[model samples]
Target: MKYECARVLRGHDGPVFAVRFNEKGTYCMSCGSDRTIRLWNPHREGTDGPTSALMIKTYKGLHGYEIRDVAIENDNSKFVSCGRDKAVFQWDVASGKTIRKFEGHVSSVNAVTYNDDCSVLATASYDSTVRLWDVRARNSFVPIQTLDDFTDSVTSVLVTDHEIVASCVDGFVRTYDLRAGLLTEDNLHHPVTSLAMTSDLNCIVASTTKGHIRLFESKSGVELNAY
Candidate 1:
């Protein structure tokens, strides 16, 4: 595989905590510890020279706290973000206006993921819980299920077709089958920092604090490889 170094977008006064490429792959959205979110057009060529890259536009004032995670809808029309202020904001990408603010998490939200259909959103928080919100319904932010056995905070979460996977500070990764209402598996030797799913939805990649990446079979929750 080959890669090209694109423009370096520099505006945030603090470290960037989360970034998501839009569905069309033409633009990218980012949020950070600076309590701001920025939108960039990565394909725009720089005018001055090769050293410069275009900074398209920016979206600000959506969060009052440090924005930790961002999830863009499939249509690219809207996006959602969670922050340390225990709030989630939904924004219209075109107008950059706050469409709605969902509040429920008692602590900082660490992770956020939108469903494939963009109808539901899942958020993980330091309060050791994951809440699901119906984006289309008003006043529908609620925790469908709470998985509690973590000795520490929940760091990341990924929602799959039939299950939800969450990583905790205790170095354990757990899977909850939404239909079964039970934790299917718990395995790991170090705190998991992030989670990603393969395009086929058959595999899951988890990054741990121990500087290791683990790949697991999504269905059985069995380790396929650990690096």
Candidate 2:
């Protein structure tokens, strides 16, 4: 495999906190301390220039504070963003308008993501809680469920078909099985900052502040390896 610099997205004014490619990798959504979200077409054609990566759209004014993270839905029609404002803004990709604002977190929201079908949104926050919101529910702004089992800030969250996984500053990675109603906890003994799952959905990869990356079996919470 070969990798090279494709194009540089130079619109954001400050540090970009998160950048996520859509499921198809044709485009991406990014947000940061600039309190703005920009959509980019990284593979745009024609002669390369300083701004070769075409900035398709810029979504702004909805977030009152620095945006911490953003996640795109599977269809790429909409995306969600969370940040220091303590609210999640669900935006329409084409119109660049906020469709809904899901607010409840008392502190900064560190991460936000959608479930497999984009029916549910899971958010991790400095409030030491992970909240789940039902996107299909039109009239509700409150979370359908809130999981506050962490003693410290919850930094990352991801949802699978049957499980919602969250990692916290408390040094634990917790997985909640939605169908089986079971909870599994894996103590890493370090403040976990990020979480990712394998494409096969069978393993979890967690990164901690101590620079440790640990892999665990999804079902059994067994540590497979560490780096």
Candidate 3:
């Protein structure tokens, strides 16, 4: 498949760290060094490009530092974002207001993702940990679980129906099986920067800081290929 730039989003004053489309692909959420989270209609083009008008909403006044990652819920009713402020924020999309703030990580958060049903949120942080928070719990500031096996910063995280996958600067990609209560660690021997699963869920693709992308069999931890 080939892709082309249909529209250029140009609202953020600083580098945008992450941009994610809602499940339906009707909208998108972006966060970055500007310390703001913006909702955009990427499908719309405004002559030169989508202007500030295409920016549906701007969430501000909460994160005191640069926003690193943003995750939109499956239904697009809410979203989650993590940043240098060391806090994870859950926002109501329509109101553009923060609904909850989950704090525990002692350092910058690098990635954030929602579970299959939006019941939970997982965050990777520079503190070398991945945390799982119960999204529907009220008045709760503690994470439901914390995985801290990394020797270096956890750079990325992804949560699926049955497992939580994370990549770290320690040169490993870890998968936690929620149902089996087991952990699988695949040592790539390179500082892993990001991770994604195959659409069939049978394999994982990991990218490293050394500029290599590796594919692995999801269940067996076998390296399939590298590019």
Question: lDDT: which candidate is best?
Answer: 2
lDDT of each: 0.81, 0.91, 0.89
TM-scores for every predicted model: 0.90, 0.93, 0.94
lDDT of 2 by residue, 122-227 (tens): 9999999999999999899889999988999999998988899999999999999889988888999999999999999999999998998999898888889999
Question: Sorted by lDDT, highest first, which candidate order results?
Answer: 2, 3, 1
Give the per-residue lDDT digits (tens) of candidate 3, residues 124-212.
99999999998988777899999998999999998889999999999999899989999999999989998888888999999998899
Return whichever of 1 and 2 wins on TM-score: 2
RMSD of candidates 1 onward, in order? 2.2, 2.0, 1.9
Arranged by TM-score, best first: 3, 2, 1
| Cα lDDT, model 1, residue 155 | 86
lDDT of 1 by residue, 1-227 (tens): 89877677667798999878977787887889888888877667656556544666678786788999898888888889898988988898889899988787888988888877887788888988888877888766565546676677788888777778888887877788778877765678778898888988888898988899999988777889988
TM-score of 2: 0.93
Q: What is the lDDT of candidate 2?
A: 0.91
